[model samples]
Target chain A: MVAALRERVRLACSWCENAIGFIQESRLPNGARRVGAGTMAFRMFIIGLVLVGSLAAAPAAWAYSESDPSANPDIDPSDCESCHTGTPEIAGTEEARQGPHANYSATSRSCYACHQVHQAYADGYLLMPGATTTETCELCHDGTGGKGVYGALEARGLAVASQHRTEVTTQIPGGDEATGGMATAALSGYQGTLSCGDCHSPHGGGTVEPFTTDRSRIETDVAGFFSNQLLRRAPTGATYEIGVYGSDWCAACHSGRASGVHDLINHPVDTSATVGPTAFTYESVQVVDGVDSPQTVQGSLGRSNFGYVMPWPRTAGQGTHAPVCQQCHEDGRSVGDVASGRIKASEVFTVTSADGGTAGDNPRFQNFPHESYVENLLIESYDDLCSNCHHPNQLP
Target chain B: MTPDAAVTPVNSRMRIRRSMQILSAVLLVVLLVLLVLLFRELLTGAPEYPVSQEGIRPLHVILGPGVGNRPFFDGPMGVTFGADGRIYVADSGNHRVVVFDSEGEYLFQFGGLGVGKPAAGIEPSWKPGLFNYPTDICSDDVGNIYVADFRNDQIQVFDADGDFLRVFPDRNEPLGRGASGQDGAGIAVTSLTVHGERVYATDTYQVAVFSTEGELLDQFGRPGAEPGDLDHPNGIAVGAPSVVVVSNSNRNQVLAFAPGGRFMWSFGKPLGNDLAGLSGELELPRGLTIMDDGTVLVADALADSIVRLTLAGEFDGRFGTRGAAPGQFNAPMDVDEADNRLAIAEKGNDRVQVIVIED
Candidate 1:
């Protein structure tokens, strides 16, 4: 075995040296003479050496002993670890030591938690035993799956109102056309696509990184650098400090606004904005009926008196909050007084924030209102986008 | 002697050089063969047919412009094979039911506009037999036809010969509102099936049981994702020994219940695309029928095909694709089997096609 390993290493080194020499010789000096016969001969020799080396190493690289317990199964369990972490052969032990699940000593941070060994229920990357990728995530993130960090978000019932609802059924368009049917397109730049795996990697590698716009660019590095909270992209590792508007992750697709093209026309979403007093307070208003007495009804959020914070930026002035795209565009479902039509509202929400956490602890923000009769997935009326921070009656 | 020795040495060198050349040639040939094999494995390409059904083919199709100036179907939603060797179709958009013999001959037609009684406070323009959107049809042993009047919120019964018998729940009773508060009527009967003396119907959320005489016997279901709960239950079928199957379309699962409405077991998962059994999933399942061997055949509207599954909800196989051809379908809504032949109602294409399921 030692002799074979030494021979393989020697062959690899020889192949690399020959390839480099061939490249160096091919480059003629600036303003020098035409290509020479010696250069052609050297190129041929390098090609022959590479072919010979590859032929000799091919069988040794693919060899597997029949008697080995982990050798050559129908579904090679070890193949996943070649690129991903959380497997015995890769960084499973190290991830278990440092990952969020490390404190939960009882939890097994293996790939099996979110993936199946064979015959996956979903199409790509073989999601867990659940039928959908969202369901597999909900098994752990729905408060009952033994994970506590996400339990509060699940308890708020935001799945139906959030823009990133995992239950979206619209088929994503634009993929390999030769397959004869619609293929699953990548999450970035594709509208109406939602799944748990779209934003988070269950293997603990992190989320999808920003790639070039060119479709032909083949990314060799499957696992990019990590970010806090497993975010897809952030300016720095300390993502919580930077508000939702500051992060460039969503800009990968919604380039018009996130890329500052709509900066002047759009409402100010920066962290510097703060909610004024008398914004979210409640009151009853009376209206006269045709018959006799007046009828009283609870006023809308636009007419409220107490100030409330928008729920996107992690930190804002006291009594104020920031907003993200999710605050308005929820799962392509109807919201807030929208007329019922052929399309139906989703029954799940994807974003919610708990109160009493430290500043910049949750990027989703706090005190998100649940679904109401609002149109376009808004948590409140269009007037309330300003009234939630600025008093309607006091507006100029 | 010295000169001979030098020549011998040169001859040996020539032999060695020739041997090296042959070895290089052999290696090049082996490498080329390996490259060819690798390329073949990597680019095997897609299958010739989208769906794999060995010998199935369409035997005939029922097109428009029938005899005696009768109107053809604008959009056909449901189809059923009666015991008397006749095919009944709920010609939904035309507001009628068209009947045809087994040989693709148009036998007769009935239940056109102005054929039924209107409800109180409702205009006389719409009635029970006069369907706004007749979604499903079924038949029993005695050839009694049951038509699900979807918009009318009633089930209109007719004789095998296309004669209107009666309407269930009566026109006088106010239709109860649905869970979504959309239906002002009592129940929105989407699909139904008959077993012995009982009639089972799905009201988009619950399965209501009724006697043959149009009396409500019992009902069980609610809007939920849990067991015994239903979400847009569109299709219903009764299998051997009284097992009731309901296709929960939105949830993308099929729920089974015993004779007394006890939740038995549910199978299928929420898959946006069309697929077959356990590993395969369902999308917008609309109509289903139980075959003689207890296997269930479902017409998946979104998939535009017919999916066959075992009684235990295991996938067998499926056929049909989205097209306007004879063997193809454009949003197939329901499927029924008779005499080893299958009848499909194409809602999008406005036609009825019959095909044989070959072994």
Candidate 2:
């Protein structure tokens, strides 16, 4: 019975695909007249095909419940698939099915793995058993589980303890009011608390796994397959890969500097114009046995690589590193202050000297630190930001 | 030898014919299945509306995108009608307050980049008339404009001719200091409403009442989900003489207060599956306004509809549907009642739509 049901579903899916293809092909050219009678007939025919296909897949949906009673016994697993797939199919589920979470392993693929059916612990969406949305993500995102996103965050103290923390109790500097500006309401989407879900979508609809290696190559390979792990994308109508230079996602909430308000007065972001070569770049550091080498390293431009290079376009001739908002600012510093050069150092980067040497090092010459030496999230003073890239001695 | 060769040739021909027949049969079956699927799709038609909006409809939409001679909005958050039947919009994204005539003609604009000058004795760093993100705007009977300069964390007063008047909660005065200290006061003033002699400013947690001259009169309300408590009050309006209404956005309800900061009553249900209803069940209610007839209209952000309620907090009726079409709203952030018309600031669509309310 299972085999037969599988075969039937496969056949139905194939038919549905063909119907969709036919409808797409039947579209009239631009400025053309109304759809012809023949086109209408074809549309009607396609509609009929959808109905029949849904009817055929109905039994297959039921077969999941009939054949596997113990499968996902917490709730009716077929309930979601019934509307999401067989009949009245929701768009993007097919793409979601191809995501890593859905196809990575058998146990992790179920919807119930991340979402609960009733009375969720989180307020808005029914997140799985956890205190908050971030906690729900930490269930599988912890180092031991799979993704290790929380592990990476915790290791860097970005998730907690650091000057910029994602915990609910973290007292954001600005008041929690929708000030029509991004600064005061920076935490709007997070429901008064910054969390992992604010940046990553667990449903795999518009987010990809953070890339750790070979960024440019992986980005080209997954061109239209997924959004960058940061959920960044090129502005609408731009022709670029999924994870290319796009800080508009950050600007969606941080509207002040990122929205071109300080275009003439401050460092440019979300612009195609590249930063001058004087800008700093992220380099890789090689540690020989446990000691760090003094040689400079180069960081990848791909965001998933966690490169120090800002996620903006490089200057054409100068090869300058244009920076995204995240490069110089975090939750602690306001975007306006950062754009105004009031806040120079970023909390994301911290530094510590090795062998009891001076704590500060040219960030461009050293690997990015995991924690800051001072209470503020800065590796050095505001002037050091320029010195890292411009080399202070070179200046007048 | 000739007979054996002929027999082998005939056998080869038969084998080839049988293979061709099998292939033909498979192709025919596939074609039949495709035809069946096409017929089923035709029967299903396009998908039905995700949520029905058959119960309510707007009378008319005005001042929408490309509707008036005024410049289009980048992010319009607040709308109000002046005493002289003119319109004032806190065009937040553009950092200006735009004025339009009663017939939707562009009159003038003020407070753009570098146009602000700080008042004397105020910090030079504070851009006086300039607005960073003006969330809400209100006008008193004498045509005096009150703007909640949200990011600036101060209320700015302007005359009818768009002249800068004075900043509220004066930095030089003790009103700027809260009970804890001067640091915790005067931050995140989201919205404001003007009564007879008072202007109510909604900070994150409490409503700070100020005299028309910018003196802090009294502040009340706290942060919580309980009645009289404001979790995230984003909108404020004056109903009757002493009645004040505030939309607690996070709680998805509107709470009313009488004079002297007494919580009168609260209405509206929490967000749930029921999208259609006459009683006040809101989803992310933001801006609100009170009509002359003591009717309160709240803009439901998620629902894309403006719900009307009586002064007593009873649901009257609602209007609007979710779309980009005229008379429709896409994530409306604020609503104001003026001259038997409703001015709705659509945050998602980046336009202010004025809908005429029919009897």
Candidate 3:
């Protein structure tokens, strides 16, 4: 029965492909592509002009959601997506199957369309007409599925508490208020609704990551896992482990210089030699180890969104060097290679999950999934984790 | 050849090539249009550049002269012109009050640095012979200049000729002697503006209306980030009905209060690199003054320029660049309007410049 259910799911996925192909073949009544490349491009160009030009004028335009009801509903998510579904057989239904945003739209009906291509995020873009930063996520996943799980966790007080909408009501200096200039908080807070577009990119890939980009413009030699096979382009061809690079996506909102939200990251104003090296050392896109640099998890990638501070290894004795993430996440210890910073390929990573079992502590435990270590992986990226080895006396 | 190779044609390559040529042509056209628009905006916006006008450089007269450490801000600082056209300065830096003519000549200097004496507390610096940093000196309709002795936490009454009339003791809560977010700070009067029988005095943090005899009729403003909160409030100006403007220096914005202390609105952003080039134009707006036509002039100290804005906080245009030239200012601190003449105190340059502001 389970096999039959899985097969049915796979068949459902194929329905999207059939619809896109059918749309591609069928012409409009006049026999022209309903919205051909030229016309669509022209429309896109005009929209781009309106987006960029209107944004350049000032962010005070009050016409965002006021002009359109189908795209910008005052209440209820279902009503918002009603007019947003373009080609009933294609856009709203089929394209979602092969797309990551599909899961988001499947469960939610009310708020699944009328997406703000941009102008939806405080960090990435400006606010659209009629919608504040808090309304971005209501476009879809109005408390359903993965987003529902996350929201439920937050609502039930499992995750960090969000006073986002309420805290902004009171005016205070450096607090969140959105009124007369007298309210200081209005200028210091973030727009708090994480949307699907905030994390995923369904259009083109390559230079742009899921929701982030390599701002440093660093060049690398190692091929990114997802790009090599599909995009036929290697964005950063540098040998580095996964998970570490994903942290940059989180920093987009957390950084202190964010115009939308209160700067969550402690941005460096003046330099202190005690903190660590600044990002100014390298002029290229590739991350290079400086004379005195932070210990990168994958030898030379990046980790943690701490703007001013970088993590380093907690050294023991005199001249010992710590192993990389791959070496730390492998099997048992083997004394094979001595040179090239390569170990015997046996030293492994230690992961203590929420259930209290070390993932790879025992060589017999081979089928441990990587998700068990996600929380620990985030914690290790901080400087606080290094204190265990830097000051051994404090560690139990 | 293999069937697999034959099954996939090179059609995608040909299609991509055609698309590229179309994309390039479209991009070029778009770029050209953008360039033309930008060029037109640049050329038509300000056709004539700001030029220098001929004449003797206007002199900035520091009206009521007081002495502080080396520059000012000591016993006396505030200076204002009376309706009779006489200049009255707090001279709080020296604990004395001095009066000068419009031509920068001293007419009479009184009030010593110490506490006021019974018969002769009429010179610079009173008992202990030193007044604290008096922030403002303004004359009412009858030529009676009210001096805001900031540090002394009182308003001293003096005749236009520098005669010591009486002292208005600090009725504000005895907070303390220091300034830290406005708390624990004594009642340091910063500015005074009198309208008819009502006198509005903005202490360090509170805006109070007095009835000539120093009786506080009502006071508003607390130290917080709320709408009506005032942080380090200074420089009071009374305009149209119920329009009272106070400079909240700490917030880097001016708060407008209604006649009865009803919070009206606030304008201006804190000075920092964040607001730099907000409009592709640099500004660090401070010291606001309203013209007869409600044209607000802001002396942006850091931006080192004077910006003109509408009453609704719209940046109209800007004048004066960063310099010590004839029309330029080093640090234009305060502005006062009288008839068609505007008096600007250039703090860093230590001069008062008079400008014939054209509409």
Candidate 4:
């Protein structure tokens, strides 16, 4: 290991064109041996290379850690707040970026690690010269899997089989972004190209609800407004609001996909769910004979439709709940049997398409955010999804 | 070459000399440009993959994107070592089990075959051998691989060579007493750890124990706000004297239990942000591993460090910092120690860094 370190330091020195050479050997106060005599030692995040004295400690020497701070004092990146203080838009974002998206800190270069702030913006993004927006995200987000792999974020959300083409497009126009739609037109597909930034706020526009532990990223369960939709209210029971901004999140692009049998929007959206333990009423007022009255159909969440602990049918009772667009969709963790698979798309979507059969197989049949095992990104194909609300007990 | 060569020998010689001079001038310009470019490149501060003396991810192996035997991993959640000195990783994102040598070299993989990327175009099948999102993995004394099938609600067993062995505690068929105190099925098994004759698992809210032969050995825990009650439990381990410890991640606490499922005590407290978990404070602590001396090491994801404690709920010390570099960690999801080496499953870096964690 010491030999490898010496070679690496030699390469680093040679590459820098520095005339680094061994002046002599020395030892520190701790009696750790130091080889190679020079003026300075190269110390970094985890690298402790001695120039005048790279402390080639014994084989059992401890690595640099927080508890072992006394080992080396002069070169540790001990204090981040010393330089990280600023407006939330500036270095303050270092704390904001602490979610699953990866808390890039220290010599890893925090914000500048991904962005070349001073200059070298590529394709209008504040990234390094040659790196594209997708490359920056895929450095970790790609299926190879690291922290921010993106999904329901639950058990099933761990591995997304298919996902949005954030890499293929340039214009991430949606919701209220710079190029996103306005009050009337919130559809990215209706006009411009769609990318990841169109919906996700890298600086954490969402947070975990009051009940759950505090988290920064706006994931499936986190209840903060995004993409022209307000959803995922806290405390999963009756009275939990669904889609405060109208349950048409996916409808921004998918209200009507085609005209033939391929029409996407089948199940109703923005309606009160009849089954469940408790359900928040979307519209509390009922116009009875030209006179307004309280909500007519109060609902509750029941045992899950597909027999899983989900938002819709978790606790069963006589309460009426408002079902939103996400009730039948795949989350970061899709509602699937980890031992089996999610959605059973092979059994659900049996129709073979032109390119063969896209039983949740092709990227085209996949949905936004992430892919699903079934067609149209449905949690289950056809009548099975509808059973979560209508004909709850009739589902097999 | 005919009459022209005879007529203009002197003129041809002059023309050749002129051409040579023009070529020399162009060559000199090219050489000067090359030298200037080389000088700039040499003068550049650091190498392109910049890491100032951290020396580029010391002794790390990238578990990667279909780069040969290393199947493209989605998210690797769990890692364990077998008696044979081979390593087993739960490639959760790919819904498969990936095997590697003790040295972190890719060996082979199984599962992940479905209507997905690595298995796309193939007919989808919900075969029991296939997996959904297998979170954590462990190996019994005999090298039988046990996977915490997080979504499937079952523990799928496999042979050392990656064959489909029997599954434990039938799926959704109700374990022993659950957090609900009722016979509830379909518990999400997020993490797991193995002892001599038992396999301990954390199902988000409770700990379910299973025998080597797939029997429900015992089950305990409840969903409540009390210290003994578990809320979002993950990462479990069993000590020598039969102390079962678990990390209640959501509540940021680690609890210990007796062999027969008795609550011993709960340890863990968030000291302060300034402390950085160096004093054994926990922030979102998950993935518990026990040393030979019954020392417990908990990987605190949010703090980007590891908290060392004892089965008796004593705060030892801690190490690690916040970064994606060697000797540093970024959202370290899991940690396992064997053969005096620590294999860290880094959720942020998307790779397992094998480093020696000594005193």
Off by over 4 Å in 4: A1-396, B1-74, B114-129, B172-187, B270-280, B323-325
Error of 3 at A341 (Å): 55
Q: Which candidate number maximizes DockQ?
A: 4
Docking class of 4: incorrect
lDDT of candidate 2 over A106-213, digit per residue (tens): 223235334434322212234344445665454323221122233232331122223334555323332222332324333412456555554444444444333332
Candidate 4 residue A383 Cα shift, in angstroms, is: 14
Candidate 3 or 1, higher DockQ: 1
Off by over 4 Å in 3: A1-396, B1-77, B115-130, B171-186, B270-287
Candidate 1 residue-pair clash tally: 24
- The C-alpha stretches of model 2 lying farther than 4 A from their native spots are A1-198, A202-396, B1-70, B114-127, B171-187, B270-280
Candidate 3 residue lDDT tens string, A71-104? 5444443333454445322242222121122322
Deviation of model 1 at A352, angstroms: 25
Q: lDDT per residue, candidate 1, B70-135, as tens digits?
A: 545766778999998799998876778888888778887877654233322434565445665577
Query: Residues A1-396, candidate 4, lDDT per residue (tens digit)?
Result: 222245444544563343222212245557665632121222111122221122223111212233445654643343433454453323322222332232333433334334422222212244322234444454334321222343332223223344554444432223222223332232222133443444443433231211111111112122331221112221111123323322333333332421112333344344332232222322221111111111122221111112211222323322333344444544222233333222333322221111111223221221334444455445555544554344343236
Residue-level lDDT of model 3, residues B127-192, one tens digit each, is 432365455666677888787765455677777776677666442343332221111223446667
Best by TM-score: 4
> What are the per-model numbers of colliding residue pairs?
24, 26, 71, 35
Docking class of 2: incorrect
Candidates' TM-scores? 0.44, 0.45, 0.37, 0.52
Tens-digit lDDT track of model 4 for B1-359 = 78877769867666655655555445445444544543454455221222222322344454553455444555466778777877787777678877788777777778863321123343434466678777788888788888877655677888899888787666535455532111234445778877888888887467887777778777787655555776566688888898888887755688898877788887765222222222325666778799898889887765656778977888887776554346666566678878666677765445666766656
